[model samples]
Target: MYYKGVYHLFYQYNPKGAVWGNIVWGHSVSKDLINWKELQPALYPSKPFDKYGCWSGSATIVPGQGPVILYTGVVDKRSNEVQCIAIPANTSDPFLTKWVKPNRLNPIVTADHNMNGSVFRDPTTAWLGKDRLWRILVGSKHDDTGLAYLYRSKDFVKWTRAKHPIHSAKTTGMWECPDFYPVPLQGKNGLDASMIGDSVKHVLKNSLDMTRYEYYTVGTYIQNKDKYIPDNTSEDGWGGLRYDYGNFYASKSFFDPSKNRRIIWGWANESDTKEDDVKKGWAGIQADVEVTFSFSSLDKAEAFDPNWVNAEDLCAQKGSKVQGGLGPFGLLTLASKKLEEYTPVFFRVFKASNKHVILMCSDAKRLLSNN
Candidate 1:
């Protein structure tokens, strides 16, 4: 959330190790998204409500309250996922470095004993309703049916379960990281999540744990009935429209009041092995874009070309290097006029367990002058 000209980002982190365990709320602040400064863990395992772990959640700026957080906490080692809240101890500090979770109001929301506690997690960022109440969605599943259990609260503390979910789907499995928000039909300005007006539509996005895909529906939000009905064109099942066809999941969207636009963020799973990730000391890709390259004749380079380039020498060089096992390669380079100094970029393909694997590299050692 953007507050006082600074952007605050809260994410799930493992304080004890580099891998996922002992989860806590990791906080960071930045004026621009490009550069960031880390603060101490904003929220962690505390009180009986969240003694196990402090998991995924979001931040919101309320009217009188500067910033409020609603997160999922594991109450016990059995993995009982319960919703909890944390408020800033000092709103005067723009970064919101300190947060206090009152013992009395610790577990703000919880599932019934009959429901599966393990599948109930990831509370959405709460939104104000037209009835002057706050509403939020918690993701869960009944067998293979995905569910977004809706809850309403006059005050952020006390919440009551709605008779029906805001939305649900069959055979979608667990729906995690459900997000609901409003967008104007014809303008760049974003509407508040609870905004009820004509000229506007609501969006409901959910991450499917079974498919590892994030799907969304854009349609009308009936505040009077407290239900979300998708448009005829919008499909709700696994084969429906997805936010991304690739490795994006667990996405959350929020209104950027400063820009008057809504922005979304997602986690992208990497296609590399776990050992490779551990060797690199990272698990996911920050930028989930696939870049392809080919050579040009004019300057022996095709700048930013998405299609495959035509480079005979590069292909020959690669084929010879690989002993005719793999073909159809290309060269990319930026060289000086005298050809004395050059930087060559290339890709090599190899057959790995009946699948073609690509190894991308820049031959700086072979191209650059030793001196």
Candidate 2:
């Protein structure tokens, strides 16, 4: 979340080790988003609400009250999750280095009688509606259906759960780091979380815990009804449009008011084993890559096979080496001078009956050496 004149980042961190236990919100600030300076752990297991662990959450800049964080906290050994809030100890400070959780509303929202506490986590950035209520989503699951439970607040303190989920789909399993925001239909600029109208379209993204991939749907948000309807243009279940077909997960996006665009951050799980990570003294890193592709035409594109329902399976069958009408085109990274060994990150386009099906593959299978 960008605050004042600096960009603040709060992430799940293990202060004791490199491999994912003893979690807390590690804070860092940057003037340009490129270079960062680390701060003390922002939120940790001090109060009973987050005694077990301080997990994933998002930051919202309240209208009058500076920035406040809404994150999931594990309350007990059962791994029960609850939504909690934290405020800057000193909002006047430019960096907003210190933070405190108020006892009055530490655990602001929790699982009700109908929901399972263990599955509820990752509250999204709160957005205000035209009716003057702040809305937020908490990720969860019911049996095989992934859910984004909706909660509305008037003062950003007290909140109430809606009768039904804002959005959900079956067979997706647990949805983590759920994000909801609006994007302008005609321009490249991004809209604030609260922005809604005929000129803009809404987006709902979720990280599937079962598949370890994330999918997003561009659609309409019925604010008055507290519901979201995904467009018929794409699938909403397991076979859906993914942000990345690779290891990206738990992504969060925020509108960059300074730049009039949105920036997304995600975790790419390490390819190495935990034992290897411990030996290296690091487990994860954040990355950003931008690429432009040019194609002559789709006239020669290969016909897409309807039987290729699973993207991962399709990529496995027709890899980068396999040529096609429109693709098997992209860059080769970490390559040797001889071209005998390299990792190919590319895309393949298959001509479906009505629309084109694109497959993005970052194949490390052909990588000959780690060096």
Which candidate ranks first by lDDT, i.e. highest?
2
lDDT for every model? 0.76, 0.90
List where candidate 1 sits over 4 angstroms from the true fold.
288-371
Clashing pairs in 1: none
Residues 310-353, candidate 1: write the lDDT tens digits.
23334444532353333335453458776667645455555444
Count of clashing pairs, candidate 2: 0
Q: Could you give candidate 2's per-residue lDDT for residues 125-183 as a string of tens digits?
A: 99999999999999999999999999999999899999999999988899999999998
lDDT of 1: 0.76
Quote model 2's TM-score.
Answer: 0.90
Q: After the best TM-score superposition of candidate 1, give how far the Cα of residue 6 lies from its true spot, in angstroms.
A: 1.2
In model 2, what is the error at residue 218, expressed in angstroms? 1.4
